[model samples]
Target chain A: MRYWLTSAFIFLLVTAFSQEPPSTGFLRHLMDREYYKEVVYLLEQTDYDDASLARKDSINYIKGWSLYSMKALQRSAGVLKSVSRESPYYLPAHFFAAYNHAHLGQYGTAGQTLDSLRLENSNMASLRAFENAGIALLQRDYKAFEDRFNQADTSYYPIKKASDKMLDFARDLESHRKKSPVVAGAMSAIVPGAGKIYAGQTGEGISAFLTAGGLGFVTWENYHKNGWKDVKTLLFGAVFAAFYGGNIYGTVVSVEITENEFQKAYDNKILFNLHIPLRNVFN
Target chain B: MFLTKVSGQPEALHRADSLFKEGAFFEASIAYERTVYLQPESKVVHRARYKKAVAYRHLHRYEDALRELDRLPLFSIADTLKSRILYETAFNHLLLDKPEEALWNFRRLEKTREEPLHSSMIPLKILILNHNRKWEEAKGTLLSLVDSMPLRPHKKQSWKDSIKSLYDEDSLPKNYSEEKAKNLSRFIPGAGHIYTGYPWEGAASFLLNGAAIGFGIHQLWYKYYFTAYITGFGIFYKSYFGGMKRAAHLAEIARHNEMKKFNDKCSAMMMRILK
Candidate 1:
């Protein structure tokens, strides 16, 4: 292991193992440099069937973590869960794998992973309860949220702020009102931009009102001056008709889009609350 | 110590070479990267960097290839590799849609006192210039390339004559003026589309504008001033301005496409003569 002879030894080892993949030393170097994508690629090329148990744990942990960084949640969960129980990486891997499943909306699988994890340290039990509570919030099971959250230590540093956000979200969800697209369309039909305002687009609704009402006024002016057969009267009348029809259709669509947007924003917050605690505890 | 360093370095590099020969570019790039990282000051480090770039190119990671090539010690690199490194850099830039950067490196290679280097770069230069709308330069380069061909005088003269004819006034791509096209469409709707080689589109645009204007004038004659102004004139104004913008865009596209087509023909003729 002398400094000068390290290169010679590495040379001999590489020559003797020419058929093998790149060394774990090189892979660890890639990890240190944050070359997660290359690490994933190298791990894929490597065959560790005859390799030591320690090396297997190292390779799987690296691959699992890299895939997690890439947001390949399903594969990350699978890889991380495969980190053997005896390996030091097993506990963090189990927690991340469970979170990945919950993020992917497989709450049953996520709960199962958590259920299977055997906590060695007392702090891990609190972390597990907090994670379960997060999954409950994400799944919109308020009763389960109450039960799981009460068991979790809200004062735990990693879950502290996230715990407060969870309470606010619970209150918001209880008060959340769902808008009806049919009502929005009917409202728009009665008043140019009324439906859009109902759907949460006040500015768009006001713009629609001015544009449609302006066209209506122009059509009336042309009709009053030149009669129905006047080209200007007919053109303005036709344009106004199209605008009125399109406005009603657009209001209904906008209401539906707004509803989806609100739902997505809420879900992202839940996912964030879940993510911050895990990253805090592990990283 | 020297023997140990020599054995260690080439062993890693040889693994990369083996992967490259097997067409396992993804693996080769990793191996070459290992060589570069572990042997940063070695003479063969530049070779490792170059090989890594080549592997990246094979993987269709042109940006990554360019990054690896950029790490080479430009001043101390062998003259032969320096020329090739320039070529590879230009090739990657071209693949990345950076024709200006590609042309800069190709021009540098043109300065090398290497005949084959010029011969290799000339065709690529013409192709790139043609696409970039440097028609005159592409023609001149093609003609120079023809003059340098080792062919019978009669055969070479015939090939050069064909190339010249291809770039002649009537045969050359029409350098459509986008400003002129837009102005034409301003004064006469659809005229720009015709100039840019789409007569049907021009006719449709003209009809739409004509209908809107005719309606406005008819309303005006009937004393419906507000209708004439708000409905008919408003529609006409929007369409007219929109047509002018469209005509300008079409003119630019027509100029690019026609130039590209003409260049391809010139390239084909040069290839035949060179063959």
Candidate 2:
């Protein structure tokens, strides 16, 4: 079918050239200009019947290119997978296949495809960028992760900035956790209020320690004076015990939350830096 | 003679109508009552009696209105017209806070009327129960009604929000009974684990404490004081902590359960109304 179309075009070209006498270079340019779309349309319309080897190669190449352009990933990957080593597009096919696999969330498959392409094309640095983006997505980095994915590789500054943001959040959270428990415990130990102040719980810590201390002092004084006749001393002791324990528990849990946040941030940074499988597309 | 009675009836009705128009309902009712009595065998007499009931109702003389309404036999009225009258009677009773009477009329009206009376019926029952402060029963009835008639608009209007409000945690005590917790823990230990959110621990403590108590009792009965003391202390410690935790936990659980039940009932009611 393609041969028939080419013959017809050639026949039309000959007649048009005979009548108008346009330059061969301009006509050649027109045919070549439609080269990509025409070939893809022919391959799509064909049912893979017995065709010439050149025609087959042309169809497959155009099919892969068309799919890549349209972002029809799986189809593009399938077409690329069949490209032979002898073909001029064998390297590009491997790269495109890896990208398609990454987009479809098949990270492992994408990594294998990229590794093969890496072996064939030693100078292709862009493959490393794709690998890093894939890694970032897996690690759940919201920031630096999508830096390599902003339509092109214009700058790595966005990735660096994002990484810095993540680092700061992590460091701040870590420092907060480190100080929280120690401050909470020290405040309570010193005078109950001190530990709460350290824990950033000014009002709560002050009230807790003061209330318990006041009750404790009152209970001791009552026990000293009235013997065991009144229940005030025993009641106050119980209240003091509960308040002290609760304050300590609250501080510990608060610090743990801060630490967890930091750990999550750090993990995200590593993932974003290594696009493990590779997935950015330039249209 | 019939014509004479009818002619005289129109004059009495005219007089009653004039008094009714003037808002002199007592006199109007009296005149209508007499007119009906004079023409007792006529349909016009029954119609006049109904009008008198309406006048009495307008004057807030519900008892008098009910009495006049009672004189018109149910069979003497057309179903459509009678349903309207019955609905009015129910509404009047409802306005007077006589829900029991209102409910009766509503039920009767419901049988004849097609527009959401069964749904309307339950709220009156709930209102009556509410008036009596039989809240739990009222809530239960509403829940049952909501569940049974999952999507009746009248039923939704009748009970959903009201039932949910009735089952609110404010209805229960903050410091609920320990016995309830014990029973719950006995079936599923840690069942009452409150403030700490550790029900498994509560259950373990309860079970271990119960076992210790059983061992202590056996040891003490057999004169093994040393063993008894160890087991007894263990039992006491576990039981005390478990009981406290369980009570606090179960209080929260019960509060949540009641709230959930209330919400479920409300949703069911709203679904009925909207559907």
Candidate 3:
């Protein structure tokens, strides 16, 4: 009787250990239904140390996807990277990790991740080429973008169409006139607001010109009427000098701000184009 | 058997309720939403919907909460549940600064309900009236509320006295007059600003007008009449009249700010009484 009872007890333990936990099933259901917040909450409360290896991978993938959905890019990348290569989810995990890095502008890391995939399929290779071109566009290396884009197989219509569009964008960017802050500053120093006009800010240029001209006229009038010995003449001269200097400095700063804004807008456009093909193919 | 039958629904609702109790409102809202999706036709769906709206309100997503409330079929619900929904809807409107809508709903509740909610509506109505700056209506409501109270003679007298004091505070005299300020500055440049309680500005205005006139006279004495007339005298005349206009503008601003403070204080006192 003792032997039979001990065997039954061991069998029950084995059955319990082999079967998936109820919570894991529930978490999967939640994730499938897009109940992301609840999935995250459940994951926080769960102790995964003793969970089976398969279950652990599933949990990490779900958590990573949840964070990604919520736009927590860095956290999503870290969690997705924790899934081992041996797991069945390894490919998707790596793909999302690279996507997250790309979204964060970590182009080099993202490129390395795609390279590690060693893509055997032409579709994936085309996708990588598109992403590489996107990276080059973000870096403002139009030549490199063209080179990478031309290497992709045109049989994939999406890649062909996207590359055509990007090539045109790159051509435009290559011919675009880039402003230099140093040049802007020098021009403004020579003639107030001239640099702003060069940077295509005609209104700001005219305003600066009017202000400095008004101050200069006031200084000249005060000195001509009251002589240099008068306090009014000296005060007006001082005001003119301060305003002239500020105008030069403001022109330089405005040029730099405009350049930065231009680059940011262009980068976002490139990133958005790169994102579309991936969603079309994968999502 | 029962647990297995309603497995996901019960667990989700329980977790949502637990989170709600812990004041994790955003998470609770999500959890409640899951329960609604899991069992849309369940008897507890109305309760879940109500709790979700409450959670959104606590999260300060007032518009979303109102949308949730609007989705509920209040006509089919129990009378007490319907009343609770109406109360929540009115309270949300009050928070959203739609005082007229809140007052209408509160009055509806008063007409339909008995005792507690009816009594509670009186204070809320008074509070809303005050918030809308209808001080006369608020005072009348307060007086009626006081008269309807079952308090002892002394307590009733105290309430009436408090209401009277509130009325007196609201009716206090104006602190600044634009006409008076303009007249003062017209006679003596900058005296109006001083009368409106800006001493430094008054001094500055006085010195500026004094300096311009002094410079004008000096230039004229030096036989530079053209420069004196065009620059010094022009500045003096403009500054003198500008000072008067500025003083009148300042007085008007001061009076506006004083009235705003008075309104804010009355609102605070009304809020305290309601609380």
Best by TM-score: 1
Candidate 1 lDDT, tens digit per residue, B117-147?
4576677777667656676887788878878
Ranking by TM-score: 1, 3, 2
Residue A177 Cα positional deviation in candidate 1, in Å, after optimal superposition:
3.0
Question: Residue-wise lDDT of candidate 2 within A136-175, one digit each (tens)?
Answer: 4544453534574442342443344444453454344335
Count backbone overlaps in model 2.
23
Judging by TM-score, tell me the better candidate of 1 and 3.
1
The residue-by-residue lDDT of candidate 2 on B1-275, one tens digit each, is 01122346788788778888988776676557657656768777876878888887888878867876786788768876687678667757866767677767866876876655455556655554544445687677767666666566775655666656655657532434456666665554456553234556765766776777776787578654544554355456667665766566666666555544544554464454435
Listed per prediction, chain B TM-scores read 0.82, 0.41, 0.57
Per-prediction DockQ comes to 0.28, 0.01, 0.12
RMSD of each: 5.4, 27.1, 8.9
lDDT of 1 by residue, A217-250 (tens): 8899878977999886798799999999999999
Q: What's model 3's lDDT at A270?
A: 75
Candidate lDDT (C-alpha), each: 0.81, 0.58, 0.74
Order the numbered candidates by lDDT, best leading.
Answer: 1, 3, 2
Residue A280 displacement in candidate 1 (angstroms): 2.2
> DockQ score for model 3, please?
0.12
lDDT per residue for candidate 3 within B5-75, as digits (tens), equals 23668888998899899999987886676677678888677778888898989989888788888888876
